[model samples]
Target: MVALTGTMGEIPPGGTSREFGTAYFDGAEWWAVIRGKPIMARWLDPIQPLQGGKIVVDFTTDGKGLSSALVIGGYTDQPRPSTGIAQEVIPAGLATTIVFIGSDGVTYTTDRFIGSYSPGDPIYLTWDAATPTIIGKIQSQATPPPAPPPPPPPAVVTGTETLLVTASDTWGVGGWGRWAKSQNGGEYVYSGFWAGQTLTGSWFYGAPRPALQGKTITAIKFWIPAREPVGSNNAAATIHICAHTSSARPGGDVARVVGPFDVVVDPGFQGGYVNLPLTFGPTLAAGGGISIAGDPYIGFLSRLKDPQVGKLIMDWSA
Candidate 1:
């Protein structure tokens, strides 16, 4: 048995492979008596090595018993260690040692040795007793996804509407001379003779009701009758429908003359009335009055004794 005292010598920084101690056993014929029996022995003092020291023990049948070799201050094939610093400070006395292990299984020692470290400071180290290295720092963070694209703009909406306006003479009684009736009471006439005088006439203006407010007038239609029986006195004349601001007859003008439509007396009289349609660009507002006027020779058919003078048809949109 060996009794060890004092330091066996400081483990070198790199390492040294050398035999430290040895043991022996007698293998002659006298030892055969105890070969099959169990033998146990104990050491009075335990072996302790400084940091980085590696001790290896071997047994050989060639006569050597327990032999030990020391690899002083060496690295092992182990994974490198990484940690955040707890504190970092210059050493007041002996400098501390730290080590680092590379991914290629090579150990590296750091040059700097501090007494302390700090939290959040990144540390890369190895199992070797080399100086610990500070690589960087770490911080916690969170990032949100990009905001969704803005919603598409709302779509525009548009449509169309129509207004049909018919003239009425119900506002008064005796001014019905503008309207005429056949002597036989067959059908009413407009701008025709009644009781021997030729009637030149104007009809009451037609305007949009409250329901048709804010609409636009797009077209106008005139329904006038051809001279009866295709007579020779039937002449061509100009017809007009004017727009005004007031409902009263011949009020302030909004659109002075909407039309001066020419009409020819139908020589055949195949149909009693003809429809004259006039279209306008864009449109006109529904805020005003519409009145009908014409040359004396042009006449419109009227309803019998109904007090309605003329029909003014309007096509509109809103």
Candidate 2:
């Protein structure tokens, strides 16, 4: 560890060590302080993003340095009701250093919460600017391909090619699932993949994007297949599906369900077929065409989890 003395705190060696609340390096050496008192030094780890813009962060600390539990609180637009903003009180003075993590990566060293006078209550560290040690040997990895270019246009304009969707491993774990298009087809597209059990019965997707202000679609239909080995969570197989329209851009989407059709049945795992009734509205067209799509993609939430599999068969004849 390259030791140094600075205004932050006492520094220590760097790496992927969980030395939270323990000695850490802040350009120079300076001990970590808890509640204005010097305690074991610990460094805060950066946070990572989850689906839907959520995040998670963590840090470890040696329990011996602080007097009381480590306080964790922050300010948010959704302020806490009366009493006080909810704070996490981690037991302090542990044999192993304690760690603190957050959903966002904003640096905060001040008390970001509002509470009555309580000496031990946790608040942001205003006295000392939070010192985050530079550590971890992270390698920059390549980003996955963009949501497979929207599903390609249908072979011909038989009826209305209203809906098209595709999904997969790249679009997070819960690949698209439970898609429905109207019997009066116009045009549509969606794409994605599944990796686990997911309930996407309510997810909506489409093509005649929001840009298509107002238009009317005639009808739409999908011939999605499900097999015995592929209907539920503990199924014997997995599946992928995509859909789209005749617009300049294609449409794509995907989704899955775990089933043998059991209590824990898969949505598209059985060999037969399913008819997801679809409803449409005036905004079918994005101020241009007449088409709409809903539940374009839905399914498993995590790649580690099991996902449903099957083919999507669409028809405009209805």
Least well predicted 10-residue stretch by lDDT in candidate 1: 29-38
Tens digits of per-residue lDDT for model 1, 1-318: 122211123333333323333222344311101113212222223433233232233211222233233222223355344533323343345654444333333444454633344422334442323344545433443122234477897664333333322333211113433333433432334443334544433333445355335545455554343333311345444445444344434322233344444445544332233344333212223434344444443444444433333344555455
Best by lDDT: 1
* Each prediction's whole-model lDDT (CA): 0.37, 0.27
The C-alpha RMSD of each candidate to the native structure, in angstroms, is: 31.4, 26.0
lDDT of 2 by residue, 1-318 (tens): 112112123322221122222232345543443323444332233322111221111222233332222213212344221111112333333322212232232222222322322322222321112332212211343222223356687653333333333222222223322322211221112222333423222122334454223323444333332322212335433233222222332233222321212112254443344443223223223311111122223233221121222222233321
TM per candidate comes to 0.32, 0.19
Please give the range of 10 consecutive residues that has the lowest summed lDDT in model 2.
Answer: 48-57
Clashes of 2: 114
**By TM-score, how accurate is candidate 2?**
0.19
Q: Among these predicted structures, which one has the highest TM-score?
A: 1
